[model samples]
Target: MAESLDTALVPAHVAVIMDGNGRWAQRRGLSRSEGHRAGTRTAKAIVTRARELGVRHLTLYTFSRENWSRPKDEVALIFDLLVEYMKGELANLLDQDIRLLVLGDFDGLPFVARQSLAHVMAKTAHCRAMTLNLALNYSGREEILRASRALAQKCAAGTLEPESLDEAAFAAELYTAGQPDPDLIIRTSGELRLSNYLLFQAAYAEFYFTDTLWPDFDAAELERALADYQRRQRRFGKTGEQVAE
Candidate 1:
């Protein structure tokens, strides 16, 4: 795998929308649960790879709020897998100095899942090498709405002024308040839409779509994404030529 992508343009954070696990399983005649389990293993490998590639933050869209619409059995399987993955990866996370954090609404999750998430987060809070943010039971639209409601409550209580709202103030209300916006967003299985993941944070993020399913993603794919990110000239609001000059 390629390494040392140009520091200037390489993404500081890479967020993934892991998709197509069900399709992958159906293709092979396996159960969706097995696909999810395989995807979890891929997640573990790529988190380590992201750290190796000098990515400071890696955010994974593990389970979206919308996922609850799926069959109840599938949803239960996902929650079970999350608990098991956290317990299994605890040692690896601590030994590798990777901080594990969860972003999203936990209010509706099963009690045991919530406890497991909290326990994992507490255990890895001190690791500084890299942060692996798992977006479990998360949705960007829901998050923004939650923040908006909080802001309104503050305004109603006279603690915040309605006229003082700005990007900075609004961002602080997000689930990822202290984290930098994702610089690159990866979606597997050739998906073309954001699927309501990180809508606010990925406003300017460069995207890399792959036909490979989430369960198949590995270190080489990550390196390719980083190398591709380095080759692009991100002008933000300006033309490429104007920004370069």
Candidate 2:
């Protein structure tokens, strides 16, 4: 699949909304947990593939703030799988030079999950080739509000001027902080909405939606998305002719 793609056109950063796991499992007469397990396998493959394709940043919507609304057992199972994934993939992550970063409230997670993530993250802290961000307990609105409140606090303390706040300053407070904004955002299961994922960072991102469920979204599908991205002309608010020039 990499051989067929234009290397220069590959996105520097890719964000994914892995959706339809429950539906995928339902179609197979399997439990939702089973579908999540299958999706985890797919995530492993996609991470390796993305690294091979030279993607510097890869963010997966692993768990959201709203995901806590799921059934208790299912939520517990998801975190268990998260722990398993972290422990199981630590070696591979180090071998591949991919650093693990979490883009949410770390203290809010279950103790086991927090411990596993902390251990793996520390072990891979020096990795420089790529960064893999797991968006656990993340909410775009909450992040924005958090940033806003931080800036407001600085203002109240007279440490930062209200007039000095700019896009860069605001962005620096985001979870993505120093990382480049995503060039491509892909959502599976044919979902057309952002679902509150990366609302601010995706302002100029090229979106690719597909009917394939998360468990079935493989390397081939990823290649297709990249191919589609390469064919488009990103004007970034400029006219096509201006960009072409």
Candidate 3:
């Protein structure tokens, strides 16, 4: 399937909702933390494969604001894993020329984790090969609300007019301001919901769902998703005839 893919049809940006970690671990009689640990390995492999496949942007839904509701120990473990991954992968990220970008609320992160994330982001600022956006502590609704507040403040200060706001203008204030909207969004574990991920940006995206857990998703699964995306016809509301034109 990979061999027959039309490279030109590959989506420029791909987003993933890595789910089912707890279930994966439960099925194996391991702790949920173990599932998250295994998922990290899969994340690394997918990032490498995305770069190799010429995907310009790869956004992984690492952690969401809702995740904070989990048990304290579980949350701590997730952050710890994040710090460890950043510290361990900084060198490989630089060597591979992949820039690290974070989306969502950074202030909510633990101080040490925040420091580690900032360090890696700064160190890889010059990487131009591909962007790896980790959507940590992200919430699409919150993001939109934040952007709205910013715009509203500008308007209140007389520096901007409400009438002057356009889709592009509004989007510029978004967390994904400079990034292209995801062309394809893949969700593992057969989940069929967006779960507040890239809500604004996924307006026209093609979605692919798989029963495979995040801990087991690999390059082949990614290729299969891309292949599926390649078969889709994105009309962006245009009629099929108009699209053909």
Q: Residues 27-96, candidate 2, lDDT per residue (tens digit)?
A: 9999998999999999999999999998899999999999999999999999999999998999999999
Give, for candidate 3, the lowest lDDT window spanning 10 residues. Answer: 236-245
lDDT of 3 by residue, 116-233 (tens): 9999999999999899999999999999999999999999999998999999998999988888999999999989999999999999888999999999999999999999888778
TM-score of each: 0.94, 0.97, 0.97
Candidate 1 clashes: the total is 0
In model 1, what are the clashing residue pairs, if there are any?
Answer: none
Model 2 lDDT-worst window of ten: 236-245
lDDT of each: 0.87, 0.94, 0.93
lDDT of 3 at 104: 93
* Tens digits of lDDT, candidate 1, 105-202: 87778899999988988999999989999998898999999889989999999999999988888899998888889989999998899999999999
Question: Who is ahead in lDDT, 1 or 3?
Answer: 3
Model 2, runs deviating above 4 Å:
241-245
The 10-residue segment of model 1 with minimum total lDDT is 236-245
